[model samples]
Target chain A: MRPRPPAMRTKRRYILARILPYGVQVDQKQMYFAVIEAATSLFGDAAVGLAQPAVVFCEGGYVVVRCRRGAENDIAVALATVTSVADERIALRTVATSGTIHALRRRMKPSRRHSGDEEVKIGETYFAVYRYPRQKVDLVEKGIKHQKSLFFTEADLEER
Target chain B: MKITDAGIRPYPAGDSTVARMALEAAGLGFDSAVAIGDAVHRPPGIEILRGAVIGAASVKEVLKRVRDPAVRRADIVYVDAGDTSFNRAVVSIKEVNVVRSIHAARRNAFDHVAARTAAEQGVAVDISMAPIIHLRGTKRQRALQRYADVLSLQRRYGFPLTISSGARSILGQRSVREIRGLCALFGMTGTEVTEALASVGWIAEPHRPVEVVK
Candidate 1:
């Protein structure tokens, strides 16, 4: 990421989206890099110059942006792209899945909140589904409370 | 921005477990997160089995015990545990400030008070963790149906929201997306969903995470 010119300070808004294929080979090592890439694209190429950019967790994924205010929607829309076999929740593909796809989603964690709602099944395969906050007042202000954790129990796992 | 009760207060954090974790966590890595817990003071009490559990007097007391200016960097992910060790730490859950219970969800049906509190304080509310709504006349094979009934109530009340595990263990953490869904499930929309997922949490931004100067 090349350093942004002084002129690039002007704040920009983006309504981002993701149409990544639901079933594909997603490597863990590359997942982080891919997330970083996805995040970098949100702020164009200038906001984070060549410093390798940064990641701010947003909606079950890392949001690489300079500011939090304008980037919320963009981040939300981008992360909605994360696909799983459960339900079509979040920006990610939240649908119940079996086989390898399920395995990957299980491993792709560092969840944000809604894990409580996500139920896991079988073996020791760990899948993270963050229980995100719901109101505008909560997200930008004090933040969501704890009782509303993603899941109500530790054993809660999405049924297969 | 919205504000809510952070359950924070002054406490005697002198040589405390949480206090040490809070200090060692800050800047040790830049990548941060935030989660507010219910500010509580365990008082010496006798349960038939446990015998003694302590309690606190007030929220302020809990905050006082927190010696560090900031609980921990709620945002700014760090790659390494030591700050200044690298240009930046690309961390996630490792960066957390165990403050008050930030995960408690308020009842959407009667959330006016909660919403107002959060707005006044400049914070997000955890509507997802609100007390489970008991459907007086509804019974089903699973909790989802019951949970769904509560969600509708939340939607109507406009409760603040958040994501969490209510995990009995301290090491557990949730993802931002999952957190967002938690809010959405309770009928959060527009800016609320985004705010909840990004709220300064265990995987949030940096110090003064909400330093917009609101």
Candidate 2:
């Protein structure tokens, strides 16, 4: 009988290796994972760009990621994880630190072309993204299912 | 009650998939189909049948099949078979087109020959029709226009021509009577409208949803 190949499904997720929020450590990690998992199941493998302890823009009670590829189908599926496509036409209007938004604005200018992929961290969630305009995408494993493979823990991210 | 026009339909491939899809459509919203097919883009379902006459390898093959007369009991029959009367009131269709596929030259009946056969049959054949049309531009339309030279087969053979919007969407399918009326709008004779619809073996069984048969 022909054996099945290793799981080569089109999607992947990964957990962060650092402490995101200090005093609210364990609670923060749980909240972040819950949101990401919800985002993944509904959105399938195409919508998520990044993972936990990531700098995601929390706006209107929603998490936002800077996306540059795919559309509504991806958005609705990844609802738990707020994401957006930033084109040359629009700048990132994130509600994080004003500096973050300003930084994105400068780098996203038409002249400053990017590789079109992204990965960031904010409080306790790791925000990750697949590259924009990519014919193929790569997503990492997120949460406990992938805990063994992880090298970093919550304690590692403390601001010593 | 279910009617379709193939001339204006935007089918993916003009092959059996379209015909099967047409059959599937019968279940979705129709019980019959006014299939509009030509050798070039006609669906392959009829061809798949072992002895389906519509699967003739050539014009001669079609003639051979038609002459057999043993299997010609298409549920419905045509009245005039030329113009709108040749294929108008068909309740559903079996599409026979494959996108961008080459077709047998002799098998293509988008000409006067098929029309001549209908003309020869006279008023005896009863078929509702969705007129085979020719347009100035567009893929299928351009293809028709390219074959316009051969269309004389329908004319030379005495088959009449009519107009239809080849149905591809629920919004695309037209009412049989309204389509016939539209043919009349285009100056087709009454006999032409009746014969065209009957040509495709359209049956009125108290309006059942469309279905697909192997």
Residue-wise lDDT of candidate 2 within B127-209, one digit each (tens)? 11222211112333333332343333433554433233344422233444334433442345556555444433222222356
Best by lDDT: 2
Contacts from the true interface found in each model, as a fraction, amount to: 0.00, 0.00
Model 2 C-alpha RMSD vs. true structure (Å) is 24.1
- Which residue segments of model 1 deviate by more than 4 Å? A1-160, B1-32, B35-114, B127-162, B166-177, B201-214
Strongest candidate by DockQ: 1
lDDT of 2 at B92: 14
Tens-place lDDT per residue, model 1, A19-131, is 12211223444444544444444334553343232222222342222223344444443333232212212223322222222243453444334323443332343333333
Candidate 2 chain B has its poorest 10 consecutive residues by lDDT at: B95-104
Q: TM-scores, in order shown? A: 0.27, 0.24
Model 1's DockQ? Answer: 0.02
Off by over 4 Å in 2: A1-160, B1-57, B63-117, B122-171, B177-186, B189-195, B198-214
